[model samples]
Target: MQLGLLYSGGKDSTLAALVLERFYDITLVTAHFGVTDEYEHARQAADAAGFEFRALELDREVAEEAVERMREDGYPRNGIQHVHEAALEAVADLDFDAIADGTRRDDRVPTVSRAQAQSLEDRHGVDYLSPLVGFGRNAVDRIVDAELDVEVGPSEEIPRADYEAELRAVLAEEHGEGAIREVFPDHDQTYVHGLRE
Candidate 1:
C-alpha cells in the first residue's frame, strides 16, 4: 500500500516512516504555510531515510484561522489540532492508500482523536495510522538512539519542518512576540537537528 506519512524532519516522524516502510510504500510529506527552508531539511531527512519526499503548501488562510482559534481559546492545543487537521485534509486529495503521522502515545496535541480518525476513514476512505502510538518516550528514544543519529534541542533552537514554527512566525510578525508567547505558552519544544545517519 502507498502510505502518505506526515513528516516533520524530526526523530518521531522519521522513525515512524522507517517502521512503516517494512509494510508499506512510504512517501514522506511535509506541510508548510508558505516558502520555508524547512522543506529542504525535510527533504534531506527523507533522503536519509531512503523514502520519497514531497512538500505540500498549505493555504495561508488555514494558518490565520488557526491563530484566530488559538487567540479565542487562550491556548494552542486547539490551534495546533486545527493546523494538523488542515494538513491532513489537504493531503486527502492525493491518491494514497493510507495516511500516517508520528504521533506517539504521549503526544497530546496535533493528534487525531478517535472520532476524527473514524471520520477520515469513513468519509474519505483513507486509513489514518500512528505507528508510534503504542510507544512511550523512553522506548522511542531508545529506538532512535540505536538506529539514528540525531541532535536534540529546544524547538526554537532547532530548524526543522514544524507547522507551529511558521504559524508562530506569522503571528509574531503580524501581532507581536507577546501573541506567540501567550498562545503557545512556555513549553518544551524539542526537534531533531538533522537527518539520521
Candidate 2:
C-alpha cells in the first residue's frame, strides 16, 4: 500500500512515518505557509528523515479564510478541515492511494471533530491509521527516545507558539482577539508566551 504521509517534521509525525513505512510505500508531504524559517525547518526534517519530500504552500489569504471559518464553527472547522483536504489534493498528482497522518488514538477524542477523520476516509479512500493510537504522548516520546537515529531536529528558534501568536495577532488586528480565541481557543500558549516581547 503506497501512502502519502502528512508530515510536519514534528516528532509525532516523524514517528508516524517510521511506523507506516514498514507496510507501505511512503512519500512525505509537508504543508508550509511560505515563510522562510518554517519552510527551512521542514526541509531539514525531511532531509534528515530521508524521505522524498513534497511541498504544499498555503498563503496568508488561505490561512485567514480557514482561521475565520474555524473560529465560527469550532475544531475540525472548515479551515482546518480544508487544510487536510488541500494536503490530499497537493499529493493527488502523486502516486499514492492512502494518505496517513500522525494522529494517535489518544488524539481521537471528543475535542477533535469526527467529521475530519470520516471525511478523509470517505473522500480519499485513505485510511486514517493512527498506528500509535493506543499510545499517549509519553509513549510516543519514549519510542522516539528509543530510536536515537531517528534524527528529530532541534526545537525551532521562534517555536510554534511564536507562530501561533503571530497568527493570532494578525487575526486580532484583522478581526479581533475575540475572534481569534473563538477560532483557535486552544492555541498553545507556549508559543504565545515564548514569543511575547
Maximum-lDDT candidate: 1
Top-TM-score structure, candidate number: 1
Cα lDDT tens digits, model 1, 140-174, are 98998888778676667776787878888878877
lDDT of each: 0.83, 0.57
- All-Cα superposition RMSD per candidate: 1.9, 6.8
Candidate 1, superposed: residue stretches over 4 Å from native: 186-197
Model 2 TM-score, 2 decimals: 0.64
Could you tell me every candidate's TM-score relative to the true structure? 0.91, 0.64
- At residue 40, candidate 1 shows an lDDT of 75
